[model samples]
Target: MARKAQTPDIGPFDRHSISLRVDHVRQLFQTLDPYPFTERDLDKDAEEFIVSWARELTGDGPIRIVIHLPAQEASSAEGRKLGNAVRRYFEERTRAVSLDLRECFRLGRLSLAIGASVLALCMLGAQALSQHSFPGSLQSFLTESLIILGWVANWRPMEILLYDWWPIARHRNLLRRLSVADVRIVAVSPDERSHPPH
Candidate 1:
């Protein structure tokens, strides 16, 4: 008898260490550009962009960066000055260009939920149809199949809806922090510590 493959345990630290992809950040930026820019918007964009760039440059490895800035609105002179100073600090400190990408976290969550629900519904319908045998009515089958397929196909857009529903998820700290850089060009082997040490 063949042994079934065991799924590895994932720890909080392991999950935290996961990095967002560059393309993902780019898409996020595209979404945010349509909205009017605000201090909060600038901050969120800065943090997400830095995090994404850091991941890309460091090869999707665990890292942390500390951001410091004055508490002021960017519309004000003091705020603008502080923002520029922080920008320069990052420009000098990090390897990649500063790109603004605001929070799409809520959108992402929504997208997941929508996709999951759609997939579940489709699976349920398929099972029902298979069990009962297809009814010979072409119109009914076509209509039902189209509805299921439409939801499945639209799963990609769930992310956008997620963003809209949740306001908090859209606002991220302007000053982001990352620490202890370790670059892994390819996915790393699961750390032995992933499981409780015997």
Candidate 2:
């Protein structure tokens, strides 16, 4: 029986739940681009923050992420608008990453199927060639060559379906976790800052 190579366990990391205070939502959304609210601008800031945050993490289990924004709106109307904008930003970014992750999985599965098919065909050819009444030395050489090619063909699909996809799957889960994280709008008061860790 052939043994599969062991891969390191990359997992849902743990951390002392993190919190970031956004004193003013307007400051966070202000971008210097000449064109405001362009296609490129949507979710740009939020994704960047998430990616940078993901990089700093080092743990073995999941942790809570909290983003606290100012509860006191500049005005009631503006406050509502600002809150809506922030929520939409994270929602759009989450959708984009989720779609990409799904596509990656789909492509990996297709490649796996194709590679396995080719490997099987090559192996069958090797067996057929070995049984033919051709010159003995030439027949043996052809059989060896086919077997080698089959293994080569099998390599990528095996890696894609087995090894490569694991990390991507793990990353997708992390992104999802981050996206749906607790987003609280705290009033401009010191009492909001004091909370015991869970």
Candidate 3:
């Protein structure tokens, strides 16, 4: 029977490590970024991979990123700066996510105000119609419709406050964790496969 492959343990209970292997350090970053290496954004695939692994490794202690590369490339100047680059990228991402979260909350607040106003107007209209003593059937229908519309008007605000912001907050927290994670570069032989250690 074949055995399932397992991820090699990276460290003790306190420190967790995320490992990545690439042929060149450039593969870790965007190809067309106009900024210097240290300020460049990480490539989409690389960022997603690192973030996914980071999420799985559990700990309150510091996390580590180990980048494995060929001995030659690993020893190059780019490798020396790889740690800083990765850290900077995550820091920027953290800030960006923070802004997105703030905007989400702002929108939620505004929507809530609008929704409340609408609900109040609906309730007032329903109350006014009740005092008119229209035909019994017509009055019931109008009152029920206004109440339903009022609640429906609040749907967006409720959704934003309860559901939409949660994922954004979680993403921001993950980016914050990654921003402060410790990064390391490891040299590997040319013959070694660019795969995480098993």
- After TM-score superposition, what is the CA distance of residue 33 in candidate 1 from its true location, in Å? 22
lDDT of each: 0.39, 0.56, 0.82
- Candidate 2 achieves a global lDDT of 0.56
On residues 102-198, what C-alpha lDDT tens digit does candidate 3 reach at each position? 9999999999999999999999999998898886599999998999999999999999999999999988888888898878777877555534356
**Order by TM-score, highest first:** 3, 2, 1
What's the candidate order when arranged by decreasing lDDT? 3, 2, 1
The alpha-carbon RMSD values of the candidates against the true structure, listed in the order shown, are 18.0, 10.8, 3.9
Predicted structure with the largest lDDT when compared to the true one: 3
Off by over 4 Å in 3: 1-10, 13-15, 191-197
Worst 10 residues of 3 by lDDT: 1-10
lDDT of 1 by residue, 110-192 (tens): 66777777767776766666556445785468557856785765656664654443433222221222423322211222352
Q: How many clashing pairs per prediction, in order?
A: 12, 2, 0
Which scores better on TM-score, 2 or 3? 3
Best by TM-score: 3
Better of 2 and 3 by lDDT: 3
- lDDT value, candidate 3, whole model: 0.82
| Candidate 3 clash pair list | none
